[model samples]
Target: MTYCVGLLLNEGMVLLSDTRTNAGLDNIATYRKMFTFEKPGERVIVIMTAGSLSVTQTTIARLREAIDDKDSTPDQSIMLAPTMLKVAEIIGNALASVRLDIESKMEASKVSTSASMIVAGQRRGGGMRMFLVYPEGNFIEATEDTPFLQIGEHKYGKPILDRVARMDMSLDEARKAMLLSMDSTLRSNLSVGMPLDLVIIHKDDCQISERRRIEKGDPDFSRMSEMWSEALRDGFTKIQI
Candidate 1:
């Protein structure tokens, strides 16, 4: 399992995902969960995945194959999709197809092959959009009422987002909120480990504006985690019943 979150605000979008996959106590490993497709200033798409690695990897692989196919069309390639909604549809279709293809084989072996993704991006001349794609090919868009999408081990980190995230927050603020949210999850879940990938897409840029990889024991993240723990403790002490 893993923890991934994306924030869609008026400014742009912020995405973060952990790189951990644990099959068992002794089978833990790190595999990046964030994938990006972009054409410089023309368009940018970020996909952060959680669940079965086979499903997510195949879905992404097939999407890339379509993009690089010599005969790829606007409807077939996400980079050339006319709108962000089309981009999500293309991804949703790919994910659903991959999951169905693998589900039967896995069922024969008594294992599960299920996965989900958070898709966020912008096309030239279009506004930024974000969606949480379900395992069955359907998805829900992030709206003003709920400017965020989360997948995987999310319950531990959702409170901060519910209380603090806003549509008007700056990109920097959004990034901090994501890190703090991840910190909360990292403390509570063993399945979600370190080496986080973060991506920021500035509205209308149609490309990734910034990206960061936070590895285990990174001083800055460690410090922030410590500070957050202290702050929480202080807040707990200040409250009176």
Candidate 2:
């Protein structure tokens, strides 16, 4: 299991994902769940993944292969896709294909394969867009009514987003909101742990504005987590039964 979240705000897009992958209590390990592709001023795309590692990795590998294939056309390569929507479609199709292929191979062993992803990006002349692509090649977009999307161990962190996030929120506030959201998940779930990958892309800039990796015991993350915990406790204490 894992926890990954992305916020689509008027200012820009913010994304965060934990690196933990737990096969069992004794089999815990770290693997990056965030992947980014950019042509700097022309386009920027960020993908945060959750679910079976095999499926996610293979899906990404195929996308990269298409990008590098000299014979690949715009319809197939994400970097050349005419629009962000086409990029999402290409990704969704590849993800679904990889999943089905893996599931077929795992049939003899009775194992299952599935994964989902959040796709966020913008092209120089196009509008910013964000999508939640399901394992079955279907998706939903972020809208003004709900300006965020999340996957994996998402429930623990969803409350904060619901109450605090809005399309008009500043990029700084959006980043904080997501960090706190991840903090809540870290407290409630052992399957989700650090280090965390965070990226921010300013609208129409078509490039990542900032990126950070928050490792376990990093002073800043530690301070933020402690502060959030103390605030939660104080809030609870102030409430009357």
Candidate 3:
């Protein structure tokens, strides 16, 4: 249980994920959920995951292995994939394959190994794209009608996105929206916790333009959270009901 979200706006893309994983109340630990693969100006891809750690970790490892394999073809390696759609397909296949293999071994134990990911990136000479990859290897792309995608403990933060996300919003606004959305989830969910990873990639840059790790008690995030709470209370007072 974690929360990961990505916004695809006209200006660029903004991705955020929490770094918390817990097997039980006493077994909580922090493990980064965001992974990035970049070739600077030629291409860049960011993957934010949620669900079984084993599944996500193995899926990512396999992707990296494919990229590093000298014999890998354009279809076999995400870095060389001609389009973002192909990249998503490659990831989907890997995720599905890994998940099936793990599930087969863990079947008798009845342990859950489900996982999902949000993939976002751009390749040189192409427009940016984002997709939400399902646990079964299928995915749905973010389009103009829905410029954002979310995974994990997403319900707690989806309201703001539904009301405010837009295809034309600036990257700065998207960043604020993403933080506020995560803040909402942090307050409502115990499974999702601190040291959030955030990344911003400007359209056509084919690289991570900016990145930040917002740890627990970070002054700026704390202040923003407090201000948001206060604003909500003030707004509540103004309501006629």
Against the unseen true structure, what C-alpha lDDT does each candidate score?
0.93, 0.94, 0.95
Location of the lowest summed lDDT over 10 successive residues in candidate 1: 104-113
The TM-score measured for candidate 3 stands at 0.98
Model 2 bad stretches (over 4 Å): none
The digit string of per-residue lDDT tens for model 3 on 29-87 reads 99999999999999999999998899999999999999999999999999999999999
Backbone clash count, each prediction separately:
0, 0, 0
Per-residue alpha-carbon lDDT of candidate 1 for residues 114-165, written as tens digits (9 for 90 to 100): 7999999988888999999999989999999999899999999999999999
Top candidate, metric lDDT: 3
Q: At residue 109, what lDDT does model 2 achieve?
A: 82
Per-residue lDDT of 1-241 in model 2, one digit per residue for the tens?
9999999999899999999997668989999999999999999999999999999999999999999999999999999999999999999999999999999899898665879999999998999999999999899999999999999999999999999999999999999999999999999999999999999999889999999999899999899889988999999999999
Deviating ranges (above 4 Å) for candidate 1: none
Which candidate would rank higher by lDDT, 2 or 3?
3
Clashing pairs in 1: none
